[model samples]
Target: MAEKELLRISNLVASFSINGGYYAAVDGVSLQINENEVFAIVGESGCGKSALALSILNLHNKANTKIEGSIYFKGRDILSLGLEELNKIRGRDIGMIFQDPLTALNPLMIIGAQIEESLFYHTGMNIGERKKRSLELLTQVGIQSPELTYHQFPHELSGGMRQRAMIAIALSCKPSLVIADEPTTALDVTIQAQILDLLRRLQKEMKSGIILITHDLGVVAEMADRVAVMYAGQIVETADVNEIFSNPLHPYTKSLFASMPDAYRNARKDQRLPVIEGMVPSLLNMERRGCRFAPRIPWISDAAHEAVPQYHEVKPGHLVLCSCYKNFYLKSIPRRVSSSTLR
Candidate 1:
């Protein structure tokens, strides 16, 4: 049987205009999220991961922004929807949990009231019913003393609690798709683990698709069913989480994994931590002719920089956007040294 696609984005292009020239921030990105699966977009900061998420929800600032391409949700092109229709779908069908809970939540409003507001707007519920639903949501997200927590203002809650409240509000409408942008950014390590666990549990129970946008490979390994590595506004590689971690094909993907602290520290003392030399090229100065990563490829020649390599399937479900892998063979990348080397 065919898996159901909850969200499908194709050739999405998002740009910011500065000094009369438009610079593409998210260019030609395409990916799909299946129902009941967690799809993650992983990249370093400013790699257009957040921009891609915002474009999916049509939440970008339009005065200085230009967005093009299709974002389809349940067969409807969300980009084509009217403002009124889009607004209705934003929370009711597509919930969003931003990176900072403090900024995402209203300072003056009580957390419970905020969650209740979504229920009131999306469902035909009275104040009492909304309150009941709000408390239920609070408890569902693992907040103890839901009644008390609901009445507290955003400033009254701790970072982790505030984040939990934000999750409650986002899930209030029982959205079929949740877009969590750096969901664990401000959290402590323990709290981060808890939040990721909660999200994983809720996603499984609700059978909803989740788009997790973060640079944290650990988090991706913990929660993602599939992973997309974004660089310079394009999805350079995508594969099942296991495949991505075990057999990354793209040089950029390999570089990212090699740079992970745990992976790097465990490497042999004689071996240098694999670093992709050169900073990400400025999007404004991006050349349309060759691979965006060509400038950073350590072993490739000038001839390889002449054109953008076509995305090729290197495994059953894995796709890499570079031809270098054909020459490097997936298994030839140096293996990580034993954990004993770290100590």
Candidate 2:
């Protein structure tokens, strides 16, 4: 069975002006999310994951930030739409779960008012109805004492409670697609599990497509239906969640798996935990040739890297960037790993 396509992005480039010159934060990226599925974008800290999420809704400052390319949601090119038109869809059709609840939520505003703002703006709900819906939303997101929570300010809540409040606000209008940018970031292990489980349950209940952005492969393994691995500003690999865990093709992807903690490791044990050598290259003044991950993979021959790396689909629904996979080895060791040995 095939899932319905909810959102599609193509050649999307989001650039910020620095020293009167523009640098691509998200460069030539393309991906899609489908209904009733969780599609995750995983990468290191500086890999433009959040930029890609924000670019989908044109959420950048017009003064310094420029976005180009098409974002098609529900068969419409939302990128070309005006602010008035986009506003109608922003909270009504699509919801965004920001990374930091403290910063995202207003300090002066009460929780119920924040949730009701979307309803007030997008729906034709009266004041009485809005308050009732807001209380129900708080309860649905696992918050105890809905009435008390509604009147409380963001400062009065714990980190986990604040996150649940953010979730409540996001799902207030039952959006068709939800973009959760590191929804569980800063919470304890127990709270993280609870939040992820809550998200999964709400997604199923609302039947919404989810684009979960995070650096946690463990979370991806537990929640994602498909995953796209980003390096620098480009997608280095993408595949079904099981395919990624079972047989990681891209060297960057393999390195990420190798560096996982014991709890996230998949039977690949060793005396020392693996770490990918070298740091991620600066996004500014990027190398205009070869693989973006080539600097960190000096052991692999230059011949294995393409001048302009492109995704090559070697299997059904599996795409790997460039030929760097051929000569990929760990921790400065030079070994040609054949696809047969990949198993």
Candidate 3:
């Protein structure tokens, strides 16, 4: 049976004003997350991944940012909510694990106080209850000596511990939908794995839907149930995790896989890992129509691309944007290359 839908975003466009004109950073994006599901948004640095996440919570500066379209969480339109109404949902119903804990957490606030802050606003627990809950959360997130860590400020904790504390605060309210934006960014590999494992175990325990925003395909492979590949401020491909790994359709998606170090093996010692040519277009300079990925893969003929691209589901439950994917092939790798060959 299909899992219950937890959140839905439709035709969402998040644009920023620069020099009197608004340029879209997340354009015409739509997707849903189900209860207990991990929906990953993967892309390069400037592909609007974080912009989309911030839009969900209406966290951008309204004076300079323009957000259109509906963000429905449990059937209520988040865009339609006022500041007070939205505040009620922010920590209690929808938690966010920000990319950088050092910047996200309060420098002067003790670790325990930060976690208690969410509970204080969302729950009616008193000081004693709040402290107990805070310590429990810190311990839950794998921080040893929760009692001692509780009194320490953000600067005193190690990077991994700070990140764990961030997790504790996000999960303090046991929110129904958690948006973890680059939750493991800047952490060492060992700590990154531990954080990922903690998130997985906690999600299973809470049965909360997760929107994992990251560029790491490895993290997506390990944690996501469904994956969306974004490029040039739009989602170019989406599919089941297994399907995305087994059959990546979009040129951008294929290029991402090809760029991974593990994708190449038994190669000539001199052969370099393939790099996706060109950069993600700047927001103001982005092509508003046609195949957005065309400029990057110049070898593919324009005839293969749709003049006005739309999602084409080449397989059940797998959608690839633009018809160009049909004709896409790496100049280095031959056509009909199997997943094994790439891996």
Q: How do all models score by TM-score?
A: 0.92, 0.94, 0.95
Sorted by lDDT (best first), the order is 3, 2, 1
Per-residue alpha-carbon lDDT of candidate 2 for residues 238-292, written as tens digits (9 for 90 to 100): 9999999999999999999887776533655444666777787776867746798
lDDT of 2: 0.90
- Candidate 1 local lDDT, 1-343, one digit each (tens): 4789888899999999989989999998988889999999999887899999999989989898999989899999999999999989988999999999999999999998899888887899998899889889999999989989988999999999999999998899989999999999899999999999999999988999999999999999999999999998989899999999999888789888876678434565755556667788777787656677776765666564336668899787799886765554212345559777996
Global Cα lDDT for candidate 1: 0.87
Best prediction by TM-score: 3
lDDT score at residue 198, model 3, on the 0-100 scale: 99
Using TM-score as the measure, name the better of candidate 1 and candidate 2: 2
- Per-residue CA lDDT of candidate 3, range 1-343, in tens? 6789999999999999999999999999999889999999999999999999999999999999999989999999989999999999999999999999999999988988999999999999999999999989988998879999999999998889999999999999999999999999879989999999999999999999999999888899899999999998899999999999999989999989878876434664756667777788999899898999999889999999999998998887799999999888886644445788775
Among these predicted structures, which one has the highest lDDT?
3
Candidate 3 — what's its lDDT?
Answer: 0.92
Clashing pairs in 2: none
